[model samples]
Target chain A: MSTATATRPATPRAELAAEHGLSPSSARPPLPQYLRQVWARRHFITAFATSRTATLYSGARLGQIWQVLTPLMNAGVYYLIFGILFSSRRNIDNFTAFLVTGVFLFTFTQRSVTSGARAISGNLSLIRALHFPRAALPLAFTIVELQQMLVSLAVLGVIVLLTGEPITWAWLLVVPALILQTIFNTGLSLAIARIGARVPDVSQLLPFLTRTWLYMSGVFFSIPQRVHAGPLQDLMMANPATVYIELVRDALIDRHDAPQHAWILAVSWAVVAFCVGFWYFWGAEEKYGRG
Target chain B: MADIQHTNGQVPTVIVDDLHIVYRVYGATVGKGNAPAAFKRILKRQKSPALREVHAVRGVSFTSHRGESIGLIGRNGSGKSTLLRAIAGLLPPTRGAVFTDGQPTLLGVNAALMSDLTGERNIILGCLAMGLTPAQAKERYDDIVEFSGLGEFIDLPMRTYSSGMQQRLRFAIAAVKSHDVLLIDEALATGDADFRKRSEERIRELRDEAGTVFLVSHSLDVVTKTCTRAIWLDQGSIKMDGDAETVVNAYSSATR
Candidate 1:
């Protein structure tokens, strides 16, 4: 995301005086500088991608098939246990697809945020020694998770087709919805990464966070139907996750309108979550670089 | 004045001023009135000390021009590593400013590194971490591998390498940068005598190309040989700053 700029901060060693736009006291590179860092580290990502696709796929029991089959298996297990045995399928149409969409999106967010949270803390050596932007830490995890989620996306499309959820222009809104979701994840990932790094306890609590998040994020039930009547419904609707899931459901399940103001709400929530998360994360940038 | 103009054109690779680094460790300040963590807390390792802020570095400042090789000399807890970190922009100073001409690469010596990563993979990351692009990283990949001489082991997890082997690889990776400044934190201590000799040669090449280096080492011999100047820090303050031979000799005598 960061392209190299002409006026990059050199190092902590050189004093820039008054003319350099540097306050003379500030040595750290700015935000755009971090993007350049991400660009520079593309080789690490590339090498890792090559190795991962090989090692993970080749050394596995199911090989590349696991990429598609893993999420399907996950959905099937959840569906059998919840949709059939528990009889929760009565609430939503094409319950399999509903569960799959929710599961896939929520899982993507969960993994991206949790793994990105540890991105900097885990690479203890690199962060301290390397003079690049730290934002790349979370982006790396998001990129890797997004790559893995590609298979899940394909499965999602196939599931939608088989379940006969008719594709339409409203379904095209899924692209923007997905973009918003990714943006939300990036912001949350950076924020959580900062929290997890300093506290140490956060690392252990992350799985719990993800699990609690799944239950509350409307993975099991549609928002409006799940919580009916009173302030509870209002409260649930206020949740960005509820909005995100609803937008996805709207696009995939009810795919024909011009996307109502509710998608606007989801998009707005994504922006807010990103801004809040980014600000929170950057606030800790100083702490992350310290010993 | 004139110095500011010329300085901008030929800025010192690194500058540090009135820097203090304090860490607010959530651990007991005094040992009394505390029990071992309970099971749940223990699982989370709730080893909280009566919450005191430990001051790691205090009011330190210096500037080094390109082609200058500087050494950090101090006892443990005297803030050598903290000082290097502050200078490298890895650690922000609590109450001062650090300025630089270009990005610096910090080469930590003798650190317990992951042996599971191959030397080559680590090299790619290490070089990239030093702020080189993919093509740039790839260009140095072979040179760094050859310099470290890990050959077949380049593909193996670093865990299998002995301490000495890991040090050589880390040194090669950190030093592979085309940096205006490079920070070394005793990371070269594990290399063999031959590697050290060759590594010394590379440090000079970097300097000749107008790069600056801030190296921290306990070895007086390394300081005297590798650096032109030295800052002897004590209790996080600069006690002596002069030619390497002068400051190191004075610090050694005072300690003795």
Candidate 2:
């Protein structure tokens, strides 16, 4: 023990350890932990990214075709009941397309957010044994969800084309919108994931919560145009999802100018969600390595 | 993340600096067997603490040079696993520091694997968890498959493997990577007599190569056969750290 205590480390371990008293020890991890994590699973993440994405599409026999088809089918069913049945007293042109895109995107965000709720608890083995960014869990989750998003987008694109919505410059906004949506999803997901690990009840109610949220998201109505008709409508329209869905729809489908408040709402929601989620998740950094 | 390969070729391989570790368990759905069946407890409804705290590892400090094979002998709840976990950096010490030459692998009694995934997929994930690169993992894949002896069943889900089989596969994966320091948490009992002998030979080879190994096991036979040194832990403190047989013999005699 005395012999072990006599020696001191000589090599630079990490910048954080050298410059600051942060990280595990005064020394940096010899091999970058990130490199180790990536090295360990380069093949797996890649294979999973491609294989799961492809297989998840369940494609060849309209197998994964359900990726896109499932949302569209839901949209069509809802459109018949809501647009044609109960709301038949009113009128809105191209209502099915608008509703489907909104419904589809809302579902993507909801699924991405809630699935992250189970991320840490589900991977207890890896977390307890290995040291990597716990962020990796939600990031992988976001990637998988993005795969579903791509399938949904393909479906929505075909519908937009068939509905005679011509391609235009506004389509460029979709890329940024998609990127913002991903960041927003990651933020919200991490936030939910932290609490969900400690509170098992959160996972149980996640499906119900998401279902209830969809109604308030205005996927079945002209939320932007008639957004202030009642307190309920006003409240729904105020939701960040409402702004996101309308912004995407306005740019891609309606080919109209977005409301003045849309960007304000979207950007604030994203920033708050990102900062709040990242810090909240980081605060629980200790739990991840525990069994 | 700390490595201490000596320029003078005499560096210690592992170090613990006043290390402490903590764990908090929450929302455990304890079955209600302890609850009163009738109105006997109605007058005294209990509202106990929700967060159960276990001081698994206390202010522990120790280190080992490159060739040391140290065994930890202790009772079931005697903090042996917790100390191993702290040294492995699996659980960060709450009050101190652990600096090792490199990362270690801690394989406990329960072989932890993603049950839904096949043994082969788990093999890949296991290697990755140990920090092996994809190409390196690929190169080592054949050897790993052969060593586990699970054979064709390697492609089947790990949940299907017997607990013993799972342990063997885990050992195979963790052993593929060389470490400046390696920690085993009572992971013996994976195979029959011959395989244990092979594992002992492998540990000897690793020690001769100047790698440090930390093993925690209740079996005195394992400590006697494999370790150069041993530490006896009880109630989160070291009772002894010295020659393996001498320490185990003392502890065993006292307990008896």
Candidate 3:
């Protein structure tokens, strides 16, 4: 009998639940609590990242070697075009070291953003099956890129030493610069993850967008020598990708100096991108996985 | 009034109050809402005609007490699985809410946990994702392996497993931790008889742990065997909710 059901007032049931310390199953935790939850799952996040990194090339015969090979191949192509053909390395010292550093470093951000765009959409099964903080997926994807970049970085170091660059104390600066870049990428990934979830087409659009970013960031050529000094020159130098690449370039190649404000720009970009991206992603904490 | 149903004064572990879930499906039906129609609507600054909304769970309300194994019985498209997902907090309710004493774990039959990873790794990842520390996950690893009965095949990637094997592994991993509210949707239907028997025993153990279990199964026999209470849903509303045998019987007779 439909009448057998007692329709109690909604407020009383809710109040009773609250009295018993029950919370809504679908309620998004406050930002602080959400951060704590994500922090609590750090082990899972790392494990997930490592597992994904390990399996990334499992199907290929070359397997994990591709991590080093892919970037080496990319750097080779850029060197052929920019160093030899286009001669865009004008006034730049140690072009090989410079181009490899830029490619490896910029690939970190590029892969992080591209994979971050697919982090939620790609792992809908994992997202729907588990109850951990959703941010873990994107964070894990970023770590996967970081792991790959580490291998590429090692390869970059070898190429730099081969190019006769001395291991000066300036090389110590690469660590902190990479740390800042990683933080900046983590934030960008988080923001892009949410956007990718909302708009599936973002993943498709990312390749062209990141390609534009790659060229604008001066991955191949020196921006100051090529682009005339103007507001455009200042904007290109201030771009976060260019800032990070310049920091690494200055650290690795003594002659290729970063602008005077590079360190300040790097730190501010990391903090701002992280805060803005995290806030943007967290704002839609409950909206994820919904149809 | 809810206390009347819980004569033993069992605390309520799950309270789904007038919950509603609507799924917004895009690119739905090219009949009237064709691409050109969508283009025209966009040009007219109107909402895309292709965006259709499916009201999946329409005002379903129920209270599950601690230690109760409630079977959700319904025909296809009757919102049984959707209700389970809503209770598990995976789907945001379009209206009302689902309040729980603790987190609800949903185990759908097809909820693949890293198909590329071997069953061994999947167990560890699944346990860790469920908030178990590395040490605790290791402690429960053997028991879960023993329970799953995959034997030598556990080392193989999960994608290599048959559907039944995957379900067993999923059930094993989920059963390792005692959840306050476990929402299982048709996960047990794929298991063989022996596996089913063991899972039934495990379900009883879960109930003795003072947790509420919600099982959505089309098999009335499995429901009558496993659940104390049964809810028969028709068209997203509760057609009947009572003792398992009575509800299953009424549902079967009505359908026949």
Which has the greatest TM-score?
3
- TM-score for each predicted model, relative to the true structure: 0.81, 0.79, 0.96
Candidate 1 lDDT over B1-256, as tens digits, reads: 2233345555555656567788776655555553554444567876654567878888887766778899899898899998877666676666666666655667785343444556766777666655577778889899888889788988887778887888888888777765777888887676889899988888888888788888888889999999999999999898888899999899899989
Ranking by TM-score: 3, 1, 2
- Please state the CAPRI-style docking class of candidate 3: medium
Model 3 residue-pair collision total: 0
Q: Compared with the real two-chain complex, what DockQ does model 1 have? A: 0.31
Global fold similarity of model 2 (TM-score): 0.79
Give all candidates' CA lDDT scores.
Answer: 0.72, 0.71, 0.89
Full-model lDDT, candidate 3: 0.89
Query: What's the distance in Å from true for residue B181, model 1?
Result: 1.6
Residue-level lDDT of model 2, residues B1-256, one tens digit each, is 3222331344456666565566776545444535462234355675433447777777666657768899989888988888877766666566666666655666666547666667877777667656566777789999888877778999887778888788788778877777667788767765777667767777787788778898988789999899998988888877887789899999999899
Score chain B of each candidate by TM-score: 0.85, 0.84, 0.94
lDDT of 2 by residue, A194-218 (tens): 8777676788899888888887787
Candidate 2 chain A: 10-residue stretch with minimal lDDT: A13-22
Indicate the worst ten consecutive residues by lDDT in candidate 1 chain A.
A1-10
Q: What clash count goes with each model?
A: 26, 10, 0
Candidate 2, superposed: residue stretches over 4 Å from native: A1-73, A161-173, A205-212, A229-238, A254-257, A261-272, B1-10, B17-51, B92-99
